[model samples]
Target: MQFFASLVRSVYAATILATTGYAPSFSGDTKHNAVGAAKAIESFHPESSFETFDVNGIDHPLSDRPEFSLEDAAVSFVQSRLNITSDAVAFRTGYANDVIQHAYIHQQINGITVANAVANVAFNKKNRVVSFGSSFVQPSSVPSNTPSISVTDAIAKAESQLAGEYNGHPTTLEFVAKEDGSVALAHVVQIQDDDQDMWVEAFVDAHTGDIVHLTDFGAHASASPVYRALPLREQNVTQGFRTIKNPQNKAASPIGWHNNGVTKTNNTSGNNVITYVRGKGGARYTTPQSSAPLIFNYMQDPTKNPNATRANVHAARVNAFYVVNTMHDIFYLYGFTERASNFQNTNFGKGGWGNDRVEVSVQDTRGKNNAFFYTPPDGQHGYMKVYLFNRSVPMRDGALENDLVVHETTHGITNRMTGGGTARCLQTLESKGLGEGWSDAVAEWTEWTNATITDWVFCPYLKRGGFRIYPYSTNSTTDPLKYSSLKTLTEEHRIGAVWGNILHNVYAALVSKHGFSATAKTDPKTKGGNTVFLHLLIDALALQPCNPTFPQARAAWIQADANRYGGANKCTLWKAFASRGLGIGAANRVDSKKVPAGC
Candidate 1:
């Protein structure tokens, strides 16, 4: 979700497809009505900005707090903001400390759920609306429920768009809302062509039998061992093998890594992930490792011939298993939990869905120079393929590079969290670029051994420089990616470098003030700039709007800080972002190198 490649290249594709094919970002007649909240909001905080897409609350209590509950307030706010009058309802509530922190609502008209019409409202400890994102398109009118075409015809209409047969799945009737303010009653048909590795949701027009819209949900990793999984310092900066047993984090993998509770699995298969290898021979289900650990320490004297290490095939799988499971554990501690729709086969009866553990293919012979991750919705399996590179031994296995693993794995995180677990956001060119950037930033965030954060390139061992066009650095010359660079760069990863580098500076800015936390992973409350940045980063993913532009993302980070730390880091964040041209005035993918006064 690698050849379809960039989880997008299969992060930017070689041929950047026009993401305009997806539904346009939502806007409605309610834009004028939302300004009332803005005026109230500005009374408390002077710098707040409101749009049809997202609203950030000021630092003070919301004036329109509902008498009943946060859900009631959410419904009311969404109704006022999005102009959705027909039975606005809160379907999900996100809890933090025995209190509702956020409410998720869907727009329903005439008893039918408006496709992709959703909004999220967040509350602080004081039950105040801190921020919210809306893609809810409240139409001027609703179409008839009756379908002019049969379901069979709708399916055929969907299938006719491509050459492959429809992957066997059920079709449902729903309304497909467009940006032009027209709503079409359609059959949402899901088609998966395994051969093409293509899976998409096709909105077949029920009235006209024409395809109204299509969303490719497959939006589209590791290890260590003294038996030797590598570190974030890259493959060459090997920390060597360190023996570890039961490495799975207790809270993240409560049921252990190997067993899914329903069936006994001794192999690398587990509740969070399942690792396997596919040979070039095209054999099906040909390789899944056994539980028995092996000494994959064979380097085959890489100086002599790196490809000779191919004798130890299982070593890559072992490293991959370690890294994948470790990332699952580390990020879970940050915020990606079972309730947040994280990848896990079992949720221990917790919130969110299950049976969606990551499906990882190590050293997959599919492509070179890249690894990819394709994330479906919360309940479906995520697919990751790490291919082999030809340069530098350059017949290098991508699984050995921890950077690649982390980068690919994070695609799942950004995808699920961005659009409230829909995995349908981040499909636009800029959003997809953000997706690539977030993945790279997360990789850079985790792989640190000291407080002195260094400027580093990605997968330098495989590629001469890095998989990206530039090293994520604070140096303007080496990584001189400003917000303005985004306008010139159309490819996702290149565009990602700009965003990622900006975050790189942001991380540096935060770390300089609060210092670094060595125990970041083990301690949730580790109060350091690096740790704080991670909180802001992940939280911002949920805070941002669907198909977010650079400015929207920057605002989300500020709002996330407001919700998390009561705006303590607002000045620090503004300064960091401003230094990189994502200051108070950045918008529409333009670079603005200016911060607010007093920052």
Candidate 2:
């Protein structure tokens, strides 16, 4: 079956040989597995668009500076890589075909050998070629005798395991098989119920026709978690007990509280504004003590609360609320709560935490001190801003409310996972979103490893009303002022949502294939949370090229999946990500071994 990308090996010659351990054996009589032999031949075929300049013994020279423009360069590269001749006579008109199974035999002007090649070309609305499928091997490796599962069979099995029985729901099931004995099955299930639309995917063993894996992502499976109510004071007391920090006080105190050097409260009030600050002085240079926990200080407009006051007790009460949000709602926050006090006049930028303690700012923009500090000079100090775009007198509007707060905190947890060094903004953003999505997915998953959210309370932030949010809607396009001008909205959040959608689908696939235990493959830590999401994201990142695009992104993930987890694992996840226009596995055709290390 034709996949989503063209079959071309574009890599530096030296890198490819070294990475793939290519000895270039000229074993003429060597017999190989039918599938393996097909793969090897496809990997070796050279394109034919460029002029073949004979050098010493190497027939074609690998030039970093080729004599062609980028567009022509691409054509030349593909022709050379696929060994396609420019002459129409070489490309037999009689053999011209569309799917990957049809092979086109072509010969070059030089003495280069001609071979059969499959052409699966995709065209856009303008009829311009968008992508190509892999070259098909002559005498196709697909067994002529064995019966393969049809798209219908694959969909039925998936629907039974995933979709269940939905009344009058129009859906389409599509399947694609590759020479590697893996099949990708996709299902688009429309909804008549109140829930949003859902897309399901399943990977099947090409030979055995057994369902290998699956994923389901739709309005039903995409609901956020229900946050349990914990009083700020009680949350503080619970945290204090955990860290044994100032137990006499019901809430956990800020860092350095026992030393008395820690500033307990620093509250400043102006005409209509009251500022509460916490964690003014802590050992910014020394290693954190085992007992002292990382506390997340939250900045909120206290005017909304009925008992608004300038008392230290009010400051302390808000401190407990931050702790409660971290420990209960966000599970990644297992660290101790060192302290929670008020800042006098310092700006903490919206609200952020450093080391293990949270910070609150008195200034509007957090005094620039709480901004996104790039690799700081001192190894021990650094921070990122959580700017509140809009706010009401009583509450922070457009603020990263409970869900957004958890999402940012997840970034903190991930930073620790990769060590404290600076990470790519893309990496941080992608991983941050994944972490957020994971929290959301887990919340939804817990509700019913299978049921859709039935109440408005489950998805409070879906939209202006209690209605479900369109998981696939392009919302960033509508809100221009909300994001940065550096990149398009699609680049930032939409791209993010695409990644998020993939994760949701993949999680569903894993559950369908192996239940909850399959999550262990990626999350060996078994932290009651899925760490596989992290590994998959990391592996994909490692394989990604320096400058990546949608197509390359898809290819990178596939290459990583094939290399790290065996191509057979998470087949459904692969198919699902591909189907969403995120780019298919075939687009990521580079041999990752050649990729530079320590990215």
TM-score of each: 0.59, 0.33
The TM-score obtained by model 2 is: 0.33
Output the number of the lDDT-best candidate: 1
Model 1: per-residue lDDT, tens digit, 418-463? 8899999999999999988888888888777567877977777677
Could you report the Cα RMSD, in angstroms, for every candidate shown? 23.3, 29.2
Q: What is the C-alpha lDDT of each candidate?
A: 0.69, 0.31
| Candidate 2 runs further than 4 Å off | 1-380, 386-393, 397-400, 410-420, 424-469, 472-491, 517-531, 538-548, 551-564, 583-599
lDDT score of model 2?
0.31
Put down candidate 2 lDDT per residue, 1-599, tens digits, no spaces.
22112325444433322322222221112122111011111212322121222222121222344442223333433355344333311333222235311223333222222222223322222223334333322221223323365545644554454334344445443233333332233333322222213343344333454443333333332111111222222211212222222221212221112121222212222111122332346211111222212232223333443124333223333333333233222232222111111111221232323332322222124432121212221122223233323223332321223333333333433333232223332354434434343334333432332312222111233223311133422233422221122134333344344444445555554445543432332134442223343345445544555335444445665676577568544455554454443322233222111222221
How many clashing pairs per prediction, in order? 21, 35
Off by over 4 Å in 1: 1-227, 232-239, 279-311
